[model samples]
Target chain A: MEFEYPIEGGDFTRAGMASSQVKKVLKQLNIAPAIIKRIAVAMYEAEVNVVAHAFKGTMLVNIMPDKVFIKFIDEGPGIHDIDLAMQEGFSTATESVRQMGFGAGMGLPNIKKNVDELQISSVVNKGTTVELTTYIS
Target chain B: MKLTEVVNKLELEVICGEDLLENTVTGGYCSDLLSDVMGNAQEGQVWLTIQVHNNIIAVASLKELSAILLVKGLKPGKETIETAIQQGIPILRTNETAFEIAGRLYNLIRQS
Candidate 1:
């Protein structure tokens, strides 16, 4: 199965909508609770990253019998240093974004810990794309 | 332990989701950072935090948390309470800080 959800930048109010939808779909598919929890955490962090940093983004999810795949493509000020951004305590979020209890510099690292495979690519002035895959087994 | 029991024991105010007072409380997690809770809090756990925002509800729901316990006399916004009601996860409040409440909650659960 496949699904797509739009992500709005700087929209803290709706940051987790896509992840919520994915959780529901996973539940309907009888995915194990443990796996679903991991996916929910990873997806939510990625979604919030878009809302906190990107101009706009889209989440593409594909569910298969043995694995689930997700791609988050965001158009905005792309990350200049992927390695630095991946560090647990590195973030370039604005003050307003951090005030809401987000932008703790843990989002991307948390996503990495939960997902089986993660790929991140970005261009200086264009955008960033994150691909995450998790084996369902 | 039932959420109602915790409410009564801790003297927590039920801000919303009164209908879910019967939910079970398996454990407690105290954290102000959203990602920490998202990455560490387990299902059925009661989250204790000073942050009062609608996203708290989102994290609680996504993690299948039993309820949210607002610490240090913090009150949630109108939208936050409404989301808690809609999601059926109780929003609870307390005058104590996370450290105080977490300790008490730990003893309560441990004794049970």
Candidate 2:
């Protein structure tokens, strides 16, 4: 099954709705508890990233019997250095984002840790696309 | 400890999942930072925070947390409540600050 969510930027209040929905579906599917937890965490972090940095975006989630694939595509300022962004303590979030208990630079790293495979691609001015896959077994 | 006891001791309001008050809580963790909570919280632990967002519920579900307590009387928005109800995660709202709640819960758990 595939699910899609349109994320609105600057709406910190509504962020993570998509990830919560996905987590619910996975639980009802009777997926392994551990895998479901990992997917939920990874997806939530990505959702927050979209809301914090992107102008707006869509989160695409594809669920299968063996694995789940998540894609976060945003039309926002792209990352200047993927390596730095991937570092555990690097972030460009404004003070406002930090005040809401996010933008700690652990977003990307947490997503990467939870997923079996992660691919991040960005153009400095165009946008960013993050693809993550987690195995179900 | 039973969730009801925690609610009564902390003087909390049941925002959602009242039926779940009978559920047992093994321990607790308090943090407003989502990243820190996501990294540290364990299963069946009660999460105490001032954050009122959908991601809070997501993190609780990820950790299989027993419940969430919103401190300082912070009420989550409608969407947050709805999502918590749908996820079967109980949320309690309290006028007590995070520090007080954490201290009380810690003592409670230690005593039990």
> CA lDDT, every prediction?
0.93, 0.87
lDDT of 2 at A21: 81
Candidate 2 clashing pairs?
none
Please list all clashing residue pairs in model 1, or write none if there are none. none
lDDT of 2 by residue, B9-112 (tens): 76778999998898889899888889878766888899999889776887787677899999998989888899799878999987878888888889988887
Q: List each candidate's DockQ score.
A: 0.85, 0.53
Instruction: Give the poorly placed runs of model 1, Cα more than 4 Å off.
Output: none
Model 2 residue B40 CA deviation in Å: 2.6
Share of reference contacts found in each model? 0.79, 0.52
Model 1 TM: 0.98
User: Per-residue CA lDDT of candidate 2, range A1-137, in tens?
Assistant: 99999999888767777887888899899998888888877888888898999999999999988889999999999999999999998999999889888988899999888899999999987899999999887
Question: TM-scores of all models?
Answer: 0.98, 0.87
lDDT measured at residue A9 in model 1 versus the true structure, 0 to 100:
94
